[model samples]
Target: MGFRDRWVDWGNGSGFYNLRVDDVSIQVFRNGFALIILPRYENIESSDLLSHVFRDLYKAISYLYNIGIVVDLDSIKQVNQEYAFNHGYLDDVLRGRPKKARVELDRDARGLFNKLDQKAKAWIDRSYGDLEIETNDLEYARRLLLMPEIIYNLDKKLAPILEELSNQIRLHLEVEERTLSTLEKLSRYIEELRDLQRRPSLFKRILNWFRRWFG
Candidate 1:
């Protein structure tokens, strides 16, 4: 039977689900939402096996969702860029807005993985029979097998949510500034009208109209 160890914490409001199938380990992070991290799989040499692993991962995720788990797929993007490529691009991707910035970053992330896979395969092809091959190239091949840490559809699906939130924040701030300016202008106008009443001069009214029209 497959082994599973899952826990949900109340106080810290963060939880994780871990499932083990043979040598693979799948871990899920749950807080405001859910993000599942696919376990490391060995043998990246076969592209067919790698594709199968991705299919199996989606199947597992579907099962979890069918059972009522709200999972965030974007979490995978972080792992793919940060752990897999060992590149410094994760920070820019995660910290940036999900609409345009995140989309752009994830494209870069995918490119990185593709490049690594190509490099690993090329290395394998070149060193297939060579006895002088170094350990570094072999390690890269192993990494290719270790399921890319990033999830699919993360940026595309969530970009709208991110864009909405950002727009709301910006709209609220802008409205507030406009309201403040209007109120200040109204207050000053009331004071001028009060002065006009006290002075009772036609010239003051004409001056006020001129100021309103020009200023």
Candidate 2:
């Protein structure tokens, strides 16, 4: 019902802000990017689930960004500075590796390490284990809420099928939430993501125009 954020240490000289709801996680990165994490479920059809989640996330971001959660130029500078310094200081990741297995950082990515100020770097890197470092720094949670990939952990299956009886009208789906007790409860438009492949319906296109003026 509400949204909140916390700092997450990404290691190797990077980290980001994290906000979550049940199984869905929203992340804002230091580099001005966002991601929404959703678990692949066995109950709700995936295409239907993606569409519903996309809309909900879009609305939530619009509402939240309009209210206050913002990342300005100054914040971007600070986060980058911190990440650059930390990455440079965390020499272990770049050193002591077999020549064949060394990390292959791109030119621009590797340059971040050269711009570091050792004195400003966090020696302890509290993000490794300390839980209390800026635990209340929600404002520093940074920006971003959507983009890129949807990583599905196949090993993290929702639930095993206990029964598969034929001719059954009802199916027990172990998906998004407990409230979705049956398959019928999923959204009526089950092909939201797939629908993008063709073209949007006339009603939907017109409906969007009306929303812009009315709401």
Candidate 3:
């Protein structure tokens, strides 16, 4: 049986299904939501496997209404290395116990799941156009598979340029602030000099009094 069939069978019987593929684990609950635990791996095999799993899982879950999939990318890297090493497989890591897959929201959790399901379906519809593509379209599948590599390469090339631009902006802001501070100090000094000049000097006052007495 296919993975989805097996998962459905188990879920129907137990109200929950848990499966492990490579370094990742997938848990689906009766509420029609799933949690995907993705691990950090530098190897190409792991990356390819992750993408495949994501596509397949999305395909399998797309038929069901009111389902949401939450992907936890950060938590997997925080897993204890020693524990992971001991466990070897994801099923072993869970110790044969299925993790709780239910999400708790205030008062309207089912509504939230339904919203998520609708959004996911909308995205899929936009991407694949009514999901009418032939299942045996190898060329289409090949292009889809290349998407991850394309994104990775683009990100790798763009990161340094983005960092450089950010640094330049920060430096410009610092210079602009210093310039403003200097202008403020200069303005205060000019204002003080103008105030001193406006006051009548002692010599000028004496000269004016002499002129007045002579007249």
Off by over 4 Å in 3: 1-142, 202-215
Task: For each candidate in the order shown, give its overall lDDT on alpha carbons.
Answer: 0.49, 0.41, 0.47
Model 2 C-alpha lDDT per residue in residues 1-215, reported as the tens digit of each score:
23334777778858877776555666767686766554433335423645765565555465447646653423322122222012334345546533222222222221121332222212223343321111111112121111112223332342233223321324333343456544444554556534643666865776688799896
Poorest 10 consecutive residues by lDDT, candidate 2: 136-145
Q: Which stretches of candidate 1 lie over 4 Å from their true place?
A: 1-5, 8-14, 19-24, 70-78, 81-215
Task: Give the candidates in order of lDDT, highest first.
Answer: 1, 3, 2
In angstroms, what RMSD does candidate 3 have relative to the true structure?
17.4
> What TM-score, to 2 decimals, does candidate 3 have?
0.31
Tens-digit lDDT track of model 3 for 1-215: 13455454544366556666556666666674566555543325524644754564454444222234444433322211100011123444445343322222223111211222211110111122222112122223344558799899999999999999999999999999999999999999999767756775954676688799995
Every model's TM-score: 0.29, 0.25, 0.31
Instruction: Give the clash count for each candidate.
Output: 4, 0, 0
Candidate 1 residue-wise lDDT, 3-97, digit = tens? 23355454666556665444445565543444444553433444464586577667766766665654567543422412122323443544543
Ranking by TM-score: 3, 1, 2
What 10-residue stretch in candidate 3 is worst by lDDT?
117-126
**Collision pairs in model 2:** none
Best-matching candidate per TM-score: 3
